[model samples]
Target chain A: MNTVIDTILAHRSVRNFEDRALTREQIETIVRSAQAASTSSFVQAYSIIGVTDQKKKEQLAEVAFNQDYVVNNGHLFVFCADLYRHEIIGEMESVDVLPSIESTEKFMVATIDAALAAQNASIAAESMGLGICYIGGIRNDLTKVSEILGTPNRVIPLFGLVVGYPAKINDKKPRIPLEHIYHENEYNSEHESNVQELQSYNEVVQKYYLERTNGKRSDTWTSQIAKMLEKQSRMYMKGFVEEKGMNKR
Target chain B: MNTVIDTILAHRSVRNFEDRALTREQIETIVRSAQAASTSSFVQAYSIIGVTDQKKKEQLAEVAFNQDYVVNNGHLFVFCADLYRHEIIGEMESVDVLPSIESTEKFMVATIDAALAAQNASIAAESMGLGICYIGGIRNDLTKVSEILGTPNRVIPLFGLVVGYPAKINDKKPRIPLEHIYHENEYNSEHESNVQELQSYNEVVQKYYLERTNGKRSDTWTSQIAKMLEKQSRMYMKGFVEEKGMNKR
Candidate 1:
């Protein structure tokens, strides 16, 4: 209805970017907007790493399965769920806060904080006529990713946000209908009805793929998800998070 | 720099809201903006429960430690990390997907998806001259909250977002300095320098609190967080998430 909502609704991940670098002023504005997001309990348990070094970007691109945008974007921002600063606060205050810091609750807070901030940054960049893509592929190998970033304990790199001028913009993918995703008063647990809704949505998604790929592909959303989930990926995430001294409780 | 960035930077939680309900159009726009956020691998592993029933809102308020805003807002949206739909997809496709759904990586993806969507919703609400607050207090009693929302297995309620016209607007809280929260190329892990930066930030926060409370309170950010973390809260979150059939790996 308005420009802000328009900006939000127009969001599409841009994988290909123009050969242009973002000015420092743009980065500052984006990061400042990120900082303004509502943090859980005001903990602000997140940090952003601006990857400008080409060598470091190359390493991150490798970690992200060689997504060229990871290296070629106007900027690369690695959002980290960080409690290391909180740990430092505990030491300075002489508070035995390790138990709570190690709790899953804190972990959730940090993760949520990072996501909220990154989304804000994304919106801010988009509003400035930039395109952004969230690179979750970095999680393919968190250990190597962390080593590349030189992140400390209690700091987990969640994902990368690559922002730049878009070389191409794809059609927005259809989402599950609002009725299927939004419940009123209480959750609607009618499994049969939900399955029916998905069945219909599956057709819509299939049509989308068919058109997008010129009838070469027609996979339904359900089939895609089921195929993806048939085998476990990132099974070591639990151990890695624990090793980072988070979510240990 | 633009209106969108301006709207994002001006955000502050509004606890005391006008006693007015959101229009259907407003809620739709908000949720649509939410759905526009990036989802990991298009999993879209989240649901939003809109609690408009008075009795349910009252129970949620109780679960949120008697935070009346839970019931008094323009609307309440309980964001859930939902894998139930994916599980249903698996059943329909006759594909075993439980192993991946139960992984910690999937849990993180769901949680991050929910947070990203919620933040978008929050910003959309704010841009429309409304105010929003994220009620992590809902985590105070997850089982009870789930019971109230009638959430099924693999559908964990992460937090609540209350949006409404504001009755009061609090001053925007200061964030950690950009230098501290923003690193260049790699994570700046210089503990001593980081601690010094925080110490400087602590004074700013203390001054803010002192002014806001009319000299009645003057707690530093570090002291506040340290005190909160000194006593573990929501210690059951891990068990609760596990019981919900998530993060098992």
Candidate 2:
């Protein structure tokens, strides 16, 4: 197997980070790699805010549901889905091109575009021998996160990524078998038989959490999601995304 | 700067591909990298259909509006946003777990998860010195692409990626300035100034197309998007996604 593939397959989210600051050159390379990712129609509807200020990182940490890693990380980047670029073009050309909920196509494109760019940045960071973790809790309270990031309309903050040298490596989380997800020419229900495989993996996941959390609460993957869903932890995200002028009508 | 950074910074789409077959080991590495990307709650809500069969690739090309590159590429990967795995979990537990439009959170996570995985796969391919081009045309007619790929409900075909050794390296496309997209702490409205910078880069983009097409319809970046948006392309994707039992309801 290729070295990169080995690194990828052995991937783990690194929350603890060495107390070192990332060089500006490092940030530039990661951002450039992000910009290089495929964009939908080259709209490039994404921007990343590199937060280095300690005070700001603390604020961001608070907004990211108080994740300690956010504050202690070497670098914190918040990826935003932006449409203001097109709005500028529209204004210059005297057209009404700003995306709205009616323009669901554009909304989807921008969101996916932002995601692709963020993913590229993540991969690049990993290749650079840095540990990284994504902060999806940025959506836990979108309005507050947006306020903290100073995000504007048509520019919803999707997630934050914390990057640094590894203080430690977390074990790789187990995934449901491919047979459960990959289907042939059409989606065949027969592939559903792989759920038992998932159950087997659940023990692996339980062990992972137990080791990490010292068995305070033995959380299985299913229960984690079930609890998350039961409370609709990030439920405000839909209204929040719209309020940020993403799915406008 | 590292060679990987150089490669990523100079990234460009490669539409015209030469006849080449990707090694099996290459496919395994790339797919494994995709699997390594972060999954939402470790759900791994996605899958890739490696379309190596020429007959199937030809059919896919037809559905994607005859994008010849899809058929000619050494590899065609259909990256799917899958909820099928979760649905099976629901079935096994005798629970109703299909995500609805009201389940906007699920939709968002699944989409982001799948795109992140695809991006990892793309970077891994690039690291191995391969060319990649994403096929958004897969969404031109979601139903057709889904049927062609045998996609299941709650598993939407987000995009296709055509990868292989490049026939030749194309010049890197210039990006919109960081100012145009990146905001400080809040959203800024100085996008008008950014547009001026874009004009010069737009020329670069136009020149790129001209060089590639021998001056055939040298459309600038803005004009290309205008032309693309002129059609109702992907306008029905939202409804189609929902109709496929995705219940983006």
Instruction: Evaluate residue A239 in candidate 1 and report its C-alpha lDDT on the 0 to 100 scale.
Output: 97
Task: Point out the worst 10-residue segment of candidate 1 chain B by lDDT.
Answer: B185-194
What would the per-residue lDDT of candidate 2 be over residues B1-249, giving only the tens digit for each residue? 555556557677888777998887787777777888897666677778888777878888887889999999768888887776676666555555653323656777778888898888887887787889999888777777777777767778888999988897776767766555555455565555567766876787888788888888587877766555545556676677666665243
**Chain B TM (all candidates):** 0.98, 0.88
Q: For candidate 2, lDDT tens digit of each residue in A152-197? A: 6777777888899999998776665554444434455455345666
Error of 2 at A136 (Å): 0.4
What is candidate 2's CA lDDT for residue B213? 88
Question: Best candidate per TM-score, number?
Answer: 1
Off by over 4 Å in 2: A99-102, A203-220, B94-102, B203-218, B245-249
Q: Per-candidate DockQ versus the true complex?
A: 0.90, 0.47
lDDT of 2 at B29: 74
Compute the lDDT of residue B6 as modeled in candidate 2. 60
What's the lDDT for all of these models?
0.94, 0.74
Q: Where does model 2 sit among the CAPRI classes?
A: acceptable
Q: Which candidate is the best by DockQ?
A: 1
Q: Quote each prediction's TM-score.
A: 0.99, 0.89
